[model samples]
Target: MVVVIPKKRRDGKSSFLKLVFYLSFREDNPGDIPVTADAFFDRPSTSKIAVFDRLIDYIDRHASPESQHLITHLPDGSHRILCEGVLCQTNTLSIETASSEMNAVALKNTRCKDPVYHFFLSWPETDSPTVEQIFESARHSLKALGMSDHQYVTAIHRDTDHLHCHVAANRIHPVTYKVADDAYDISKLHKASREMELKYGWTRTNGCHVINENNRIVRSCSKEKSMPDDAKKLEYYSDQESLYGYAVRECRPEISEILKADSIYWERIHAVLIRAGLELKKKDRGLAIYDRVHPEQTPFKASSLHPQLTLSKLVPRIGEFENAPRVMEFKNEQGEVTLTNYMVSSHYDDRLHLRDHQARMTRRLERAEAREELKLRYQTDKKEAKCPSFDAKNRFRTLSMTFRFRRAHVCVAVRDPLMRKLAWHVLAFEREKAMAELRLKLKEERAHWYRAPENRRLSYRVWVEQQALKGDKAAISQLRGWAYQAKRDERTAYLSDTVIECAVSDDIAPVELKGYTHHIHRDGVILYKKEGVTQMIDRGETIEMARPFENEGDNMVAGLHLAEQKSGEKRVFSGPREYVEKACSLVRDLNEMGETSLTLTDSLQQKRVCEIRPQDKPAPISFDSPNLTP
Candidate 1:
């Protein structure tokens, strides 16, 4: 077992130190005292009962059944106490009585700086010692520390993987009444730990001070071949260490040549190491390389690989070397040698924060890109899916029919399955061609408008008026209201002009709804945003866009309005009132005309409602001749 007595701190206010102070005298459980002892005291208990009560409470709260009783000198006046289970009960009354007895003796001597001393004796993770052995060890250690006759309590705590004991000693001796001195405490602990390690046949550990100084390197060494296997230990070393291990084992000669040569060129060695996935960093402990992929792993130490690679030896050969520009160096505090400053720059902290931010943004971008790719693939797959081959014999026989629109009709013979698909394709082709012409016409008109200085002046005057109204609301109340009305009027006119431009571009062709009129604005069309929804002007009033709702009552009204305007109402229905009232009339007429619907199902009529894709279209199927109808 290894024993450690932590360094005493001047800061007495720390909570952890306070816990250790109270835990030493606490009872393992409430009211469970050994039956063999006689209660005796020399001093009054009034001045210190509460201190002992709090100590017992800390123990009871953290206690288990086995370590509750206090072990002490046998009442038979023998040196050894029974260590099986029972000691004095650690409850309030018993603790108070013991403190009074100790205080009575302490009153005879001068007060000490610390009246209580605590020690921790920890064993190996694999070992499980009995309570008797642990108390015995604590007894022997106390004797070694020259506190053999002092009254003390030992509690074995088994909460961690390693079993340990906390021993608290009252500095005042019961007989001598001399305050205990802790001079050379650390050295005594080291000697006692060595003695116990030999006695228990457990692995020995150096004093805590020595173990911490070497960065816990010696602690990793077991009494047996206690270090973890090479693969596991390598994780604690830097990437350079791993590469050094491999290189020393695999290519020792080349590395030796580079190290021994005067006026060493680092690039040559760096290039060689980079090929093997290694890069050197001048660290506080000397040259090391961290793994590129697992930088959290400790860097491999070059000196550890071979003594010649030590900073003292390597620096002489390299001579007047300039370290990597980004690696800052600082003078050694001990005046030994220069060392790399791993934590010197304030900007490095900001850089780390920025790197974390960039990493989060990169992950978001990757997810967004993945979603977009999936959407595109889905659309492509849907387009590539072939329509179920149309059949005429069992499903629908070909029939000569006349399809009529207002003042226009066509007669043809087609199977029901093919008829819907054929008509949709014809309409799509016509619409695409008309939109192309519309785009060209819009470009020409925009050019013409920009060429007119009067149009530009009018736009600038409107902007200036709006800005003036916004600057001082109180001064321009009536003018502001008038300006707002004028702005609305201007927007309405712009929307109406856009609709006229569309009409002129397509040569007054009837508008077809392909669901593209919402959200997006083409060259000749403008969609105004309002109340988080897209809006457009049909006449003078604002109309909410619903281009995709083709079979709805509102859509039918829009289509009728388009068709009637194309024929003769084009010049007459220019104002908002005329356009809105005409649309209401169209909706009434359409409702009176009744309704018709074409329902397509998945299994039998899946592809009948789709427009044709030119690349995947089958050979043209000729229609049978029929008499024309109008």
Candidate 2:
């Protein structure tokens, strides 16, 4: 959450001296500061004073003891020589190397040689180091910035702490200084900062968002609804645009404001001051490359706040004063004692998960890629198997031709099952229409004088009368029977009482019905003439058949055919039991071939199904005089 405020963010509202005022006062009084600072001392840092004072006020009101401490930078002008304080400034540098060359690009893209840029360096008390360590670390950090194709240069000033450093690097390549190609160029720097922080555990004190996939939609739903429980994960989804008073440009949201007709992305980020609340500042055109969202969230700036609250006094107030203030001490009675400087053991460790997760991800990616390569090599001419020239292996090949399709279903669980159950109601309606046509055609085949359905003027009553006059007994009976069945079918099919008399029914012509049912459909799930039984399976419903036969013919030839829903346009498996069993098995195999199975995805299929084969079949006996069943 480290954010930088550009010079143009405000009209010199927060300066270096004022920043100092805030910090100095924060040490004295918690948040008790006048809105206006009429009483003032002519200190060198006015903005820094204001910033420090605000920070103290913020900490006193909001920060916990564990959270409130200030990181300081020892500016270049305070060095001394031979016990004599010098007016001249001396600067040093330090750099760190990254493990992976790919990750080292950030350090390679910056170029800086100036001293004032030291304004950004963190100045912890012990950061100062010997001149040798300073130059060596500087070279490492510079190498991190990179050079060449996409390279940068960095200069560090480590003279302050034992090994403290400042990196003045450009966001773009040093030789090219390439302008960013996004909504803004500064975002590049923000991303670079984030990469550095994540890869290296650098702490940023600005507001941070919790990284999650569903953050935005979940936030919107919770905000719009009365969801107290949903609010827990909402914290990390917000953006941090302010630090003390600096503006950070990140997380612009797409919104359609009241006055605006079209939608535009609005800058939505918060500023962090110990106790400051959320701020929803809007940017009309969106953030520019160098633009800061809202720079002066607080009333002060940094340069003015540093001096009076030196590491010496402010440390005790925040209660983080680490080193003893005692320069030298002695005691003499019967014995004498003297003091010398000694370093405390360090208590810090690097983030281990960062490296570990990266390694796992890389390995999995390599495995996936290897699988892809194997498939590619086998697809040389998929036109023919084994080039016919190598007919020896035509039945089988040593190399696997397996591939993972991009859209292959790996695994699925239905989120809503009821919707699926409702959809099957339509299928029942279609079957009913087909059944009615089949009955009508049977009457026509008996020479019943029924007008063609194509004739709009022919009424159902008139058609029945004409058929009855022809003296076709079978035709009359079937006509009557079909009418009753159609009504029954329509009533039994739907979830609601309403029946569908749609185009499929009305469009069935009298002539078309003559041979409309030349091929009978016997879906295994719902067949009216299946084994002297009529089945009506609901959507998501499945049927299992007991193995009826387990033997083949000795002197008799046996044929076992598997049928799935009579091979109709809509497969429902209302056919013979043997056919049904085979259909289900084949389908199960196809489903298992997929990484994610169809049955797993189907919300209606809530129960598990398994079918076991007998593995042995008795021989069937055949007799010409007397038919013997196996």
Candidate 3:
């Protein structure tokens, strides 16, 4: 597995944030991971002035959906996880690319040994930490890490019921007021998480590393096949008078001492042969042939055995032999034997972290694009029909009627089928994301109503209109919230351009970044860093922004200023005593007029109750119309 300790550079930090928030993905995505930034943010609903605050609030919410994210397996057997998307990042991120706020995280005076800001962890959808469980665990972990900032952890979009938890952390320790170098015992966090995953019965695999230099290559001999097999051996070559004299004088004593440990070690003396110009490898072994004619580069001929001796001739002359070795021996019919054996060494390889990071980025982007595509499915008009005849106050009473009028996607059983209907669950979150794609078998008659010609339409206008009925003020507030959120998102997009710098491991050449290395030590990389000259992220980078001119709030006195805003009307209505006193005569008249309708309804209900008392109560209420809309 590869874990990257990203360099703490302000420029890189900018790009990191930018890549995270400006993320894009296809709304029709079939895989997981949010590629585009919008998948993590809420659409803007508030005025530009408040959008930043709305975004920040969202980021802090610790959002969670029914299932956290979708997972896609790559061809190489790795995976990508697409977490639920958001409408904005302003709620969680403090750096405003805009002018009103300081980009404190991007300061010049800050020491940045550890600058980890936001974290988004995802796992396969097939296995997971339950939404509630994840919420608790994430909160506990973040708090244990000493991050009490509520805004830092969020379980967003649970209402739409997609699963995903996000944390936006400040790398600097608030209490110590020290920048976390990330060189600390951060493994403890992952270990603890693994323990928790085990406790919760979740599957976990921390993937593999993929660097080019960590693998092996083959080598070939310079004049291998051209030489005879017998010519490949060079036992008696050292027996030559001059060679034997030089070896006895310069090396025989040392060689004899080493041979004391293993007499057969000479069988594996290929390395020595190569050095003395008698052996060559078979493939492209990263070494070049120095001289084909050199005895050192070519094999020694067996015919050149010293003293012109043969095995039988030498053995008879040498007489008795001691220490007959435990070599691999084969017996003939007469029990005479011959011996032979060979050996090779054993080792494993390693990979690079940078290569892994780039690969991960690529896979992540692919899955993100898919989830974004699904998000656009929401733009289609597939909302359940509303029953104007029935009041929401008694939603349950119209169950039967709703059934009759229900759309294909609508279901009304109290039983939660989330487990059985994974697609339905997924779509629920996608719908909340807005203006995304959802594939559906089209109803020819309903084609015009769907967003795409193949299916149906979901209108942004209609959603707003229906919610508007909740309360004029509430609707307006929600709208403004969305508007404000959009602005914050634009600001966060600025962080994607920062530059980051980190070095290669010492055992590896600097060229390893773009080339390759062969050595693989038992110990992994020893991280050494070059601290940047700056100490803090610049907060002033964004402070110059003026108050939004177009979205400025009403400036008149509180009550009057709110009139056009609609919320003012609610405030005035709360003072019923004063209004009632002013309209006392009108109220009296209205009370007398309401008795006619009230009396008629009461009489009809009484008659129905009397009739149903003898049998069953009549269906409590009629269903809303099947073809109705806001």
Candidate 4:
């Protein structure tokens, strides 16, 4: 099933560039495998802006050896750059340039509180699509949401079992500078997901919007039978079966059977509900079912469960709306007061146990850390008390004396009219300095207290993340489930690992090439990166290149020289016509100058090398490009 999730930042501090970086890089350990695919759509005239430069530098910095830590699984010197492309950009701007333009356009519109619209399109573990398919899906989905003209950055990640795509789009138009309409966005997304599932032959999942009998998209529930917004949220976040859902799934059929009696009454309905550990109660002029154990929770509306269970329908059939008897007369076959006990869900017990265990561990660790911190604080206080310069009592006495002297001076000056003004000004200046010092000291102390390790308690979410990093499969599953839940919340983007494995050769020793930062994977796959250039040398069998710009042939040639030097063999050169011609020219010049023995073959002479192509052109631009005059 395909899930479309729109993410929003409740704090109103979202940034386009920040979202781009997050989607394109790993958060747990920044130096590991980065983006699997990165692309841009609907950008401005040029990409040679300052923002693009900064982005390139940022990527290069992270890929450097200095960023690697022990936790990084890659070899000590290697870094990986998977793939990057550009689509529907004016002037055919690069992804970096397009992202920079997106941020600039967003900054121009101050009225729009959130200019960046972030969302995710995810598929289940059973379905896996190629990189091309992911890009195609993103384009189709964005067009469905009326965002074909918006500037956006998309990246595909493969860190988890399921493959997902992240699209960070600018809400403000480039030329019009108006915010895009987002009304009924969830409905639009549901319709889009349904379309994709049908087109791609994917498994279908339940949603609020569905295709109707007329073959047109429509909402599934009527206004009266629709679920409350709060109940929907509860179902999304908890993941466990909600009380309302439990009633409909387990009790609705039995209630229907009871209503088929020859002469129905309130007692029969009550007895059936009582056996199922549920009770029917009057709720705001309507009948609702509440779980016997969780009376405080939200109840399921009778009409929402089944039409026959509604108060209007039940009252007409059973004579009047009579309340269930309060006597202890109902009993199940087991002679127990209740049977078929209601549970949140089958997994509730496991979730509860995990939650309790985590809480206990957190509390124990916090207590131990707190005691150690207290001991250290007490020792520090003792040392400070011993030092006369750090004595609190002396400082208090000095402050008191200063205050008294200032007040006495002011009083004396007030008696002499000429000197009163001068004395008051001097006293005020001294008082301001003293207050400033006190405020600064207080700020420093507060900061130190908050920054202390012992003062920062671990939350359940953070604890789960820590465990997942430690390779706990259960923790990983829980974390992934949380991501699925957040699809309904739509408040944050979820990212997983993006590690890719490449073939490695054991015969060749590592070679350090000039002007390129070398990143070696744990399995001996070496990646070389420079400005506007990315080349991967997996042992000796294959040479891969990432060309995100129009003109970087010199850098590519330099990388190829290094690859040939390390491999000690002649490699075929195959790519687009332009790149092939350029490689031939450069290699010929080098061989003639006696600098190297290099050979080149064009696409016509040999089979073409796989090339990373831009996505199909997006729908026509919504706004005209701004005309520039010099």
Candidate 5:
């Protein structure tokens, strides 16, 4: 048995006294009452009195029921009868002037800051004393708490399964004219209740024990009571359950569809709950749904009903719904960009996703432009070169070869030499620019490898590799642990790029000839083959050659190889056809004049080559050249 001091809740627009009186005595509005009633068993007495003796008699009559006799023990070892019988009367407390007098006392003690000492004395419904015993126990407990000199009333309510009493004691003592402080009253009541239980021979229940769901003490049987027959229970059933069972069941298909699609909002669940006579209300800790008819009952947690209704689950869905506006960027044929919708929703993630999508679209658009540029360059080069177009042999291929040969020959007389040279120069510049970008990207990739994550160790694997080289045992262990993550990390691996390298082949034409393959290797080397010699001409100054030679008639097969030092490495020079022809003519003149025995020094050859440098180089001398005989 526990004398529970429930927090007093004021009735709407009611004074303190009136609210307390209504809580202890009313029957019309259940919300006003402090305690629920199970059944009206008996009203032993009812009266309206202000006289001291009359108040005592009123209590005497109310405490003694017809079915139970009241016995009081005196200090002189004598016993007396305290009450008579039950009285059938109307609600006397509701019509009494006690409220007004209490109100007057309350007004007189305006300085008093205490609240009405209003509380309930509840017992377990299954095992409790009779009404007379409960009334006597409450009276004795209230007096022991220093409320004996105060005007108070006790209403025994049996409307609930438990037999309980509602006590509304005025805090301002009428005689002492002093305000009462009932701060320690709860501790006194607990002690008194324990003594009363032993004195009255009732079942002893523990106090300040069992905790309810709200972390408050379960002071009464009311906290443990099951739902009334008329009140609805929220239960998961295959057929029907809860007040809004039909609506809840109706949402199954929508839930399935939403889950399958993984989209939309939680509006379907909200609508379902609303249709089922339930509403979602915010609590301090979470969200709960309650039945309209029985809101006083324990509410069903939204999460308890279903996994989908949890706060975490609903946040993203609700966020998506609340932020459902799409803003897209469209480009006109004139290349002007415009937003499809001028207004967008005020959600950060929505704007972020939109920005990401637009960026991807822009990248795709750039790639398309790059492809178009490549096609346009191909067409322009073909138009610039005056090469013969053949349907079987590609016109683009013929144009490309002629343009490359004219550019590579450096001094050759070919149709539209300047335009072909410009075309070749632009292609080389573009390739070099592309290679520079790739190199920069590769450098960034190497930096990214150092920042790659380790295996669940919150460190970088690059540091571990450094430690492993120093033979640190811990670093070795860390390295082993980090290896798995390193393998998993795509960034840690070497990212490859298209690098520029010179390619050598025998099928290509020589620098002097114009036919077949005509692509310059990325290293700026032009490879060409003519007669029995294959030539590799490097841009700027140097050239190299590989050949087989034979003596024809009086012409000597003297293979004079000259090497020039570039960056401390010797590079061979392959002569232009005109220069070679001039050199051969000079040599033939020397031999005819019988000057074969003359010493040929580097200075003499350099002077002669400088003299012929002003003339534009001609194509390679074929076997049919007028100056050559086979």
Candidate 6:
């Protein structure tokens, strides 16, 4: 069992309505709320609660009638509602009324920042609990958290591999307007999960709290053993074992045995570690195991692998620290190490390319460092030069003006008009030249002082994305691995699949056509925008509107046409009957206008030619044709 409390939005704001809406629908299709009105109204009720009745009434009035059958079917042939409302308030209120009341109560609390608590409880795939069991578990978990009296909305979602229930509880009490105490919520949730697992005889899962031998819940003291954070993230994103993890898994037992021997020596440990492509070295105040192949990467802390490997412990056992030999021969042949930088094992060529790119980046970083040093040197020189202060410079300028005026007076005192004029001219030329030189010097100094450094470096993920955009298969694979690790929804997963083959063509490039602007993303995902609004997304193999709008039919037809133009092939539009009909109608219109020649084929491969004849109107397309597949 896993219980997760999602963090609040980055802005630290909570909206009950938005959370409810998200819980009520599938991530891909927001237009349809999968919960039926009947199922919602059939929920257990303590009284004819006005709030609950109001919410049901609202759903009945606005919810789609066809939503009653929106149950999702698995490939195994079992069907279940994608999302079902399991429980609400004891008074049985609708989602809208509950949100409204919760928002109203939240307004009374001026101190509380986050007014909503959104948490989810999930069971393993092996267990398939009924709706009543799920509801009871949610009620039990909430009651254990001291949120029994608070307004909350709970729904069961079966869209994923595991069965899970989402609970959105208002932190502020509806009547008292006091925020619920959420201290130790994680421990409380874990305790609740343990209880539910026991009560239902479900599969047991580890948590922070566990039942002791005395049959009482106690805080678990067992240390959680796992890969290092960086190593774990690398494994997750690259689908390869990290160097630290590899050392721990493959080399730890032998190293531990060596440490356990009667005469523990540093040579024996170093030999074993080296055989595994690892080296033990002193780092900081402790020892660390560094990857032999990629020394630039982070190393594993010695104590993290085994307590006895610590510098203090090992020093006491072996007398003192001893460095490994520069070269050593092993009786057994050394096997090749699978781990590399970022734990990338597959796609060796791509790995080499990435390494080369990183090398270039390292050179860039070196240049940036050199520039920084130069900048600092320039700053130091400027400081040591002791340039004139602002006040001193102003005073000097005044003195110079006074000297010039005195010089002019001296020229006038000569009592020769021609000599005085010539002296003034010479002084003006000298002053102009001096001012120009000063201006040029100040401009150069300003340029040097404000020159920005080229220290920008792209992160690994961003670099991979850039490579993927350039149609690198390995980069695309790495991105897909990341998406898989993220557990993105089905639509996003499909979009992240193998990159579609896109033939280079100037016609398909980003440009405005018939008021719609086309934009292509990585892996040939095309987006059609109009007036700065995204209208549709064409993922080469599939096309979907961004949202349902009045002109969705037009957008759909336009997307199909654009996709065809880009692919240089005839495209078949497959979707709801209405959308297909609209596309066929548009195609017929285009054919009748003598602008494009096209033919519509039925399911039986019978093609109907659309011929432009100004003398007679064309026959209307038959939707009820027996041969048509719509």
* Candidate that would win on lDDT: 6
| lDDT per residue (tens digit) for residues 1-630 in model 3 | 112222345654433233233221112211111112112223444344354453354346443543224344434232233334432222232322211221344342276633445544454455545555664555555554555442332323222122444544555443455554433334534544554555665655342211123232112222111233332222122111232222233333443444344233333333333233332222232211222223343323222322221233323544332222223546688986543342112110111111112223333343234323433433443444322332433433344344334323445432457643665555556553422221221233244444342232324533432333332222222232232222222221222122111111101111111111211111111111113211111111110111111122111111121122221111111123322222222222333456211111134333432343313422323357575544
- For residue 624, model 6's alpha carbon misses the true position, in angstroms, by 46
Give the per-residue lDDT of model 2 (tens digit) for 1-630.
Answer: 233333322332322223222212222211111111122112333354455554455435453434333222234322211101101112211111111121233334344221111113232343334443443343343333342123222223222222233333323442454422223323433444444434444443222222234322111122221212222122112111123212111111111121132321111111221112223322332211111223333322221222222334333444332222222335478565554332111111111111112223343243334434433533542323221222323312311111112112111232345643444454446545645665566556433322333322323333333433343322222232233222222222322111111111111111111111111111111111224332221111222222223222100001111122111112233345444344344345444556223232222221222442334222335564366543
Which regions in candidate 6 have their CA more than 4 angstroms from the true location?
7-11, 14-17, 29-63, 68-92, 211-217, 223-244, 253-265, 312-316, 323-483, 486-630
Model 6, 1-630: lDDT tens digits are 788887678776777766765566443321111112121112233233633463475566555544433244334232333223323322224445557777888899999888889899998978888877886787788888888777777778765657788888888877888888999999999999888877787877778888776666678875325567787676655555566666675577887788778898888887777766677899888898887666786777887777678877777778789886665333334665444332222111112111112223343343335434534644564455433333545744865696598676867686788887777777777777776676677667656644422222334544444544444434433433343333223323232121222222112333345978654333334456789876765543345654332564566456545554543333455555544544555566665667555444343211322332333443555879887767
lDDT (tens digit, per residue) of candidate 4 on 1-630? 455665577888776655665565443322123212121122232234544454677546544544422221223221222332212211113344556787788788999887778777788877776665676677677787787777776777765556788777788887889888878877777778777766776656557676665655567674335556555666666654455655665566877777776788888777666655677889898898876656776676777766678777777777778776554445688885563332222211112211112223343243335434534644564455331233445765777689778778678658886687777777778877886787677667757765564343334444444433443334433443344433222212211111111222212333556767654322223456666334444333345555512354545555456545532333555456555544555555566568777443334322222221123212334445575333
What TM-score, to 2 decimals, does candidate 2 have? Answer: 0.16
Cα lDDT, all candidates: 0.43, 0.27, 0.31, 0.54, 0.43, 0.58
Q: Model 5, poorest ten-residue lDDT window?
A: 346-355
TM-score of each: 0.32, 0.16, 0.24, 0.47, 0.26, 0.46
The candidate with the higher TM-score, 3 or 4, is 4
Please give me the total number of clashing residue pairs in predicted model 4.
Answer: 7
Clashes of each: 10, 88, 124, 7, 11, 1
Mark the regions of model 1 whose C-alpha exceeds 4 Å error after superposition: 11-111, 172-181, 206-314, 325-630
* Residue pairs with backbone atoms closer than 3 Å in model 4 (clashes): 75-521, 77-519, 77-520, 78-519, 78-520, 79-519, 159-497
How far is 134's C-alpha from truth in model 3 (Å)?
A: 3.0
The candidate that wins on TM-score is: 4
Which stretches of model 5 miss by more than 4 angstroms?
A: 9-26, 29-95, 209-630
